[model samples]
Target chain A: MKVLAPIAAHEELEMLAAAGAEELYCGIVPREWLERYTGAVWLNRRSPKGGSLDSYAELKRLVDDAHKLHLPVFITLNSPYYTAEQIPLVLELAHKLSDEIGVDALIVTDINLLMRLSQEKLACELHVSSVAAVLNTEAIRFLLNFGPSRIILPRSVTLAEIATITRDVGQQVEIEVFMLNDGCAFEEGFCSTTHHHTVGAFCTSLSEMDTQFEWAGKSFTTRRQNWLRRNLTDYREWVWYVNGNGCGVTPKGLPYGPCGLCAVPDLQRMGVASLKIVGREASPFKKLASVKMVRDIVNRTRAGVPKLHVIERAKQLRESPEHCAAGFMCYYKVDESA
Target chain B: MEWSLHIGGAHELASELWLSRFVEADRSQLTQPWSELAGRLLVTEFGDIRFTHCAFGNEFCEHLIPSVSALQTALTAAQQQQLSFTLLTPYVSNEGIAALRPLFERLAGNGGGEVVFNDWGVLNLLRRDFPTLIPIQGRLLNKSLRDPRVTPMYATAPAPSSALNVLQRSNLDCESYAALLTGLGVQTVETDNLPQGNDLSFAQYGLRIATYAPFGFISTSRICMAAGLHYRKADKFQPGAPCRHECQTHLLEYSYTNSPFGNRDQKFFLKGNSYFYAHTESMLHALFAQIRAGQIARLTWQPRLPMTVAH
Candidate 1:
């Protein structure tokens, strides 16, 4: 269970560690936080030309060329809340990424910057962000008193709620999950909207908007609300449906979004130590064909194979062919009897 | 400094003249009885001390799990309305904290209950196992920006002061983030009356805020397209399927004409699944002049029910 990915540059670190990427996460935003929060505040949740990195000397040479190939970089001060003059420039860039560019973990998602990095002990490894929704096991025993080593999780739970949180706290912490690109139909830490200026990612413009079905004491020009809006014109039965379907992008176009690779054999029998792969503003050759297609489906689920031939070898490495039977570009969903 | 009446589901038409019922519902229409609730509700007032979601979990909509005989008949009708109960949680998973340990031991033996935590793991499981209830802070932890397509462009422009300070600032207006939510005993914070307005300056961080009104949930999803329209299979609308509650049967009215400043009539409301934006009475008379300038001490309100009613 290790693919992680998403590094933004320093020449995409040896093609994302020669297209396997054991671990790499990123986000930097320098140039004085894009000349004073120009993307209307964002030192993380991307946008300094998205998937940041404009110096800490190019994130100390992309964490010294991905820690000479053993990977491990992490670093996205995942914003879901951060103000108080932007918390001392996000705790002076988390104390220069933990005292001058050493970063091995900081993902975060503002529970007041995880209680100010566990009340300023701030050494490094913190993780927690799927914008900190955490989802159960009492929010991982309430972020195990903010000494996180990993949490990610929230893509709105269920793989039997991630096997009821890695079977109860899966040995205290480290869970990670979303094995591929963006899928949120809202729940990124209770989505407060404004994902970026100019209608872009407010949950993908909340699926091309349009609604009105009033009647708890009438009037939207009630005639049974105009015959329930001209016979509910079937915008695929709304509630912001969304299913454009894309196993495509990145000729520097970059959006090979939503791809669970049929839930990597139940997130490796729910041990899920890490799968991640979201596109920190993608395209390092679509993050090297999504870290060589989830490192060849996590090495064919560690070579034990047969989860229906690793989901027909992850539907022939996602040329889809209706493999995940496209349930809105499903990520973990793959049941019709596997 | 308190008005409350959120009631998310069928509490025999709630109303006993305020003082609480953020009573949302889910664990099967929260033990129904507002004339057998199958949605289409809208009554007001409060009392019969009820505020629910025992285990505080909801990304935006999908609740109702209460059963310990429906929290012992909603705690014997909130101890015959001597009222002192509140529980609306969400964001839980150690199997929803082992299925909310018998509704946190029935709100820790009901000694004046109250528990609205939008998951700081249920305020560290009510500060290590229900230390006699009372936590309050859930408006999905109030992250702000409640977008009904940019609240009509932050209600007619002039919002670029870093987008009106990230839409009326709040990390509980930092004083060490309100002393780390009042050192976790969390005195109260649940707010959201923002149709592009609300600078009740996090009521200077001392906590005790409580605002909510006319629907303020900008996001929520256990992947329900109104409980996947009786599943003729569109991935059976995802999240553990089989929900016949059908957003308590109908309510999905969205209408945003692409406002990235293109701006046009933007109305959004969808009952019982989550997506709302409706607060004008001059935004409740500017939240009643910030509840008579005490900078909002409590309001809660929410009329237009059936997001499966259980606040």
Candidate 2:
């Protein structure tokens, strides 16, 4: 199985390669305010609502650089609900990426667009975004019917569930298991902390819109900045739930528990095609070290090369005493005309 | 709310039968036999009245003319000293909205509380063509806005009035039994039956069902539309081994009950009880009678139609 790590800068990519990342998926958003709050005020400027995929020169450079080390690149054009107008722009961008950038695959969720791509033979492979909510092996099969090479499973899936799916559907398509720094259940794929609560806009339709939502009295607008502020310079959680105790269906970042640092061995046993790390705000140094730790463990574990020693290495590598659990990006279904 | 009497005739009450408590249970407590004493429901607990089309899948632009006529007739039939009708339009193309201009012309000189608007394009057009049509963002808009965290059923109303920009272009739809029935702060909610979370399918859940249609259908709409009454037991496949997939042509209509068992049983079923939707609608209409009974500043519709009784 190949392992992919999402990186922001070339520095991050270099660190990922040193860490043994199979592939690198990156985004085009400023990272500072992100450190502050995933608050509505902070928007991905390059891909505003219905925004086009960022140009390939920089992304291509990253991909080209990764290729030197034999690492592949899967470009993310995943967001939700492109208006009827954005469709042409998206198809055009898909063409450029497939024909020009030579990306390994384009991770996507939009059905109408996917259906269109099913007809045209494109260059890059298509993997359903986890936000498209492929939960079971049956779902993977249905998605495969559309002819995708891979299916990004939902973040909320348990290791047992992953294994079951891989057992049933693994031969049909590659399964991508998340490795590190997924904030919310899945699609909220960023590093989450206790100090500042970061809520991912799983619902991508309105996420890009410079709009606010009015529901049940308190309105949460995407564009309007929230006045409340807090600081979380310190991070600690084992004070809450016992290991394997509250691991079932708890949202990340509660007062009592450390967020889920999950079952990598089980994922390996399940035999996923790729081990992906969902990186959002991890410092390049931490990301590098994290990648190195995970890659070594995966290589050792998969090859039957010193398994316990790799576990020991993982324990020491996962500083902050917090384990790193990986999962898929959350996708929502708000296609313009689903 | 528990009531003393059952009311309404067959055709009208068929939709209300799902509210078995009000229609069926209330029958035991009534002094009058559904005809005479039922009339008191109008004077007691009803407010502004609304008449809507029998909601089915995808009413196209072409259906608007007949829909308008149906709207008028249903409105006239529903008229009483207190009852005023709300013309419910289906989601149609902008051309569908344009067609309403003539209908609006007929209703203009004689105006009342606005015609509920759901389509954004229609909302834009109606503001110019028939300002009186009173554009309200229907729950359909909210359905399209698939924010799982924010359900129309949760808080019971659209956020607060402050969250809304309520210019003339805005009237809200607080659908009856909407996710949050009382949460949405719409001027009024059109209800057939209280929304049961069962068989609820939306664009989001659609993907979940692609692999298992019966479960998908159940998660979407509880009642089967075609059979009119019955629940599906298992998720059905599109074709292949079962039934030769013959039902694929009219999948939406017949697919609701397409069982994986194939023809093993004379009555294999899955996903929804469309008849339940029917019974629930009538049940809701009677409940609407109780809900609409109190308002002072609106036209109300509560008189039972003699022609449509549940047989």
Q: How many residue pairs clash in each candidate at the backbone level?
A: 36, 69
Those runs of model 2 whose alpha carbons end farther than 4 Å from true positions after fitting are A28-55, A185-262, A305-312, A320-338, B1-311
Candidate 2, residue B295: CA error in Å? 26
> Each predicted model: what fraction of the native A–B Cα contacts (within 8 Å) does it retain?
0.65, 0.00
Per-residue lDDT over A1-338 for candidate 2, one digit per residue giving the tens place of the 0 to 100 score: 77677666655666677768777775543243233223222122122212222345676787788888888777665543233334465677678777887777877765445665676789778887764545455445545656888888655455556777788878888898655544331112111101112222321111122221111112335432221100000000111111111222213221111222234555666788876665434456545655665676776677774444555555455443332221111111111221
Candidate 2 chain A has its poorest 10 consecutive residues by lDDT at A227-236
User: What shift in Å separates residue A35 of candidate 1 from its native position after superposition?
Assistant: 38
Interface RMSD of each: 14.0, 21.7
Docking quality category of candidate 1 according to DockQ thresholds: acceptable
Kindly list the per-residue Cα lDDT of model 1 for residues A1-338, writing each as its tens digit.
79898877788788778878899988888787667656666767777776778878888888877887878898888878877777888888888888788888888888878778877776678888887777777777767776787788887677877887788888888898887766776666777776665777665564566654533333445566655554343324322333223335534443445677777888888798998888777667777878888899889888888788887887777675553454565656656374
For candidate 2, the chain B TM-score comes to 0.37
Could you report the DockQ of all the candidates, in the order they appear? Answer: 0.24, 0.03
Write model 2 residue lDDT over B60-144, tens digit each, in one string: 1123233345445434444431233344443442234455556566556445444544343344455555666544333333222
